[model samples]
Target chain A: MNKFREGGWHILLLLICLVLLLPVVFMISNSFKTLQDSYHSMLQIIPLHPTFSNYTTLGRQIDLLRLIWNTFFMAAIVTLGKLITGLFAAYAFKYFSFKGKKWIYLIFVSTIFVPFTVIMIPNYLVISKINLLNTAPGVALPQMCDATGIMLFLKAMDKIPKSLIESLKIDGISSHMILKDIIIPILRPSIISIGAIFFINSWNEYVWPTLILKDKSSFTLPLALQNYISSEGGTNFPLAMALSTIMIIVPLFIYLIFQRYILNSISNSGLK
Target chain B: MNSSGSKNKFLTIAYLSPTAVILLVFMVIPILYTLYLSFFDWNLISPTKNFVGLENYTSIFTDSVNRKVLLNTIVYILLLLILNFIIPYFISLIVKFFINKMKNSYKIIFFIPSLFSLVVGAMLFSWIMNPISGPVAFLMRHFGVALPNWTNSSAMAIVMLCLITNWKVFGYNFVLLLTGLGSIPQNIIDATKIDSIPRWKMVRDIVLPLNKSIAFYVLILTIVQGLQYVFTPISVITQGGPYYGSSNIFYHTYLNAFVLYKTGNASALAVITFLVFLILLYLEMKFVEGRMGNCE
Candidate 1:
């Protein structure tokens, strides 16, 4: 009975894995086909004459290096900015007994529940009036501070023992030193977790970027890819798949490299 | 003026200033300003701003399209909750039970789609589901079946959009659920074994009850995020579709403001969306917070 149950579980697992992998496998296989092969009915599963021509075409179609760099720089800056601010706010909420802290934390948490649709118009107006429209900073600025990240960091910081803070106070170390030397060092895992999430969130953001950046030269990888995907006739499925294959793979590579930290962050999102 | 003490407060605020100020000015203020804007008729090109009290809100209540958008928003949220919640909850458990050594790897693979830009993910799926050359169509033909265009129908398009969104976020959900699963203490399972409880009873009486709080957290978070307006798929894949099948309240607001430049109508829609979000959030907090307390 035990062996049979185990075998049944393994088979089910294999089936689930296959379903999870199907689209990704199809994407890679389809990416190598010629545009003509993609349309042919008989040549569906496997490309009869696979070629690197679509990738070669993609290289020329978009400024791959510049777009990638723009996206990376934007995501990195926001991640770093969010980390600094989130840590400070977390420290304040966790340790400082400031008046109205409860209301402030409530507001902070409430901000996570608010939708961007409600604020997009006003935010766009504000961005335009500040003379930052169509600029990289405009695209990146509004998204820099995420309420969820601050809340996560705060909750994690709360878990640190009061004894630790008492020890720092006994040593006459200022809150600044406590945060920098003691708190931050202890919060390294949470920092990495938060950093991975912020990086990925900013990287994947599209709606705001589409609204803010109108110049083609300023388009990020995702925006540029969208334009490329739509500009062609629907028949260019192979090229679309090829570009998407690259887009999916780069992030997939990043997540794989830091899978542990990213998983830790996803878990953090739940506890708060 | 006390220099040293003031300096410490300044230092703390300074460290916290960049993030807090950005969120306040950009996120909080904009939302409030949007609420205010909904009360008036203001077009961007015109310098004239006319204040009309409660006109926009009243119009939202009466307008047919706005009414439909509201219904669509609710439906979208419900569909997405099922996709991101119920499906992933089971998937996470299945993955955990079967795949031990490569759990982390599976988590990473699942999260890959979500980490990519929304537009990119949407566009990829759009191609894969295209009626003529999409893989879905190809498979149908292989089995000698003709597949209808998935994104061409209003109802089916919304369903497909929900499915794609689910596929995109499932890995993240699975990871979260896995963490919750891992948090379940081993001694509890041992206790169940000692009691000679059946497998189903062990799950019902122990695992589910213990992890109910995290489950609620996941459910609330998924619904909130879903209602925020998934723009990528709407814009890239459906453009609100063959006849507005995929359009939700948020995307409808986006179209009004950006595409049509009807600032007044768009702000009205925005107001409605905000109210809906607040209502759902209040309910979730009220119920879930109380339930979480009981779990202890």
Candidate 2:
């Protein structure tokens, strides 16, 4: 009876996972299929005959490597920039006991609630006005700072006992030395956690890039993907799936590798 | 103390300048510029501008198309509230208390869809749910069931798009709620064991009360983020199509400015959107627990 109860829940949970993961499985599975095969063979979870021809189609239509590189470059630059800037800001936020600190923090945090729609037109105009449209830096620049990282690092810094920083302060240590020697090492895990989130976010960002990047060469993976679809619609499903699989693979791998950190980052958000 | 205080102030500005500059340049200025643009008519390409004054705002109400788009926006909010908020809230509870083995596996699996770009999601679902050649349609036919072309009908089209957003967001929302549930102290549950309160009752009484702050936070996030998430699917799959049936506020604003070159109208709509969410943010600030939205 006890084994039955245990087995029952396991089966149910696995069954649920299978259902939820079907789109992903369907994607990876169908990507291996031929165009004609994709249309007819709905039942085949695995392709009856797999081939790389569909994958090759992606190569012919677009600069697949360049697309991947563009997205990767943007994500990397934005994530690194966010970390450095957020670190300094969060550190300043914690160190200061100014008269207007409360109002200042509120202004920083209020950026989160400014819906992207409100700023889309003006940002686009600003970028184009400055002749930054169709550039990777243009796409990455606006996303380089976020309050989430500032808040995460600030909270983590708060948990660092004040006495530790104070004891060092009596030695008249420069803020630079204290930050380099103490804060960076203590906040390493949190930096990784927040970094994973920022990286994945920039990787998947679609809308801003759509407005900013105009050249085919500058297009990120997601933008290139839609470009492929609009031009080659209904001509090939397997090819489309292959492109999607390619676009998804990196983020999926990152999430799997850093699953703990990503999950921990999110969980930490709601708790505090 | 005076010199040190001035030194501290200088360093504070130095440390804060990187973030402050980006936000001011990208965020603050944009809001103000959008507000300024809302009052004038400009094609964006041409140098000429026409002062429309309040015509854009007035037409948003008087115009039938804008009214329908607003209605569609309301529908999007309602459907998204169900898909991303209300439903995930309940599911998180079940996952937390029941069938708890391999919990991490469940979390990982659920969060996978969220990891993919919304563009990829749009492509995958459009392929999978294609009425003619999609696998789902093909599978349904074998069972003597005919699949409806939900994409053609504006109402069903919106529902389909919402479901697309649900796939990507539900897991993210679930993880947030489950993490919130985990924050409830262990002793409360242990104390309840003496009374042998039914699981549902324990959840209703003890769990729900303690989870209020995080729940409110998730609720506000679903309304705000959920609208943005649905935008990609609408543009990719529907293009707010079948005669603007599926277009919401965000998509409509995009369409007006970029697609139709109606910058003033788009700017006006954008201002309205900012105000609407600003009120929601105000409510969240006033009511939600200070800490839940902190460290966000």
Task: Please name the candidate that would achieve the greatest lDDT relative to the true structure.
Answer: 2
Q: Residue A160 in model 1: shift from native, Å?
A: 4.7
- What would the per-residue lDDT of candidate 2 be over residues A1-272, giving only the tens digit for each residue? 64576577677667757766888888888889887787777558888888888888788878888999999999999999999989998888786666667677778877876778898888888889898898888999877746777877887787788788877876878788889989999888888878988988899998899889988899998887786564124736677778889988888887867898788878876666
| Candidate 1 stretches greater than 4 Å from native | A40-50, A155-161, A231-235, B1-8, B95-108, B288-296
Off by over 4 Å in 2: A1-15, A230-235, B292-296
Give model 1's docking category: medium
lDDT of 1 at A10: 62
On the 0 to 100 scale, the lDDT of residue B235 in model 2 is 85
Please provide TM-scores, in order, for all candidate models, with all chains considered together. Answer: 0.91, 0.96
Show pairs that collide, candidate 2.
Answer: none
- Kindly list the per-residue Cα lDDT of model 2 for residues B1-296, writing each as its tens digit: 88888988898899889999999999989899999999999977889889989999999999999999999999999999988899888878877875547778888888888888888888877877777777788888889887787767899989889988888887889899999899899889878878888778999999999998889888989888888989998888888887889999999999999999999999999999999988887887786747633322
The numbered model that scores best in TM-score is 2
lDDT of 1 by residue, B1-296 (tens): 36756765676577667667888888888888888888888775578878998898888779887777677777888888888898888767656543445566566667666676666657666776766666678888879998787666777878877776776777777778878877889888778779878766777777878778778777877887765536677887777866566788878888888888778888988887788778867776675564221101
**Docking class of predicted structure 2:** medium
Model 2, position B145, has a per-residue lDDT of: 88
Alpha carbon RMSD to native, model 2: 2.1
Query: In candidate 2, how many Å is residue B92 off?
Result: 1.0
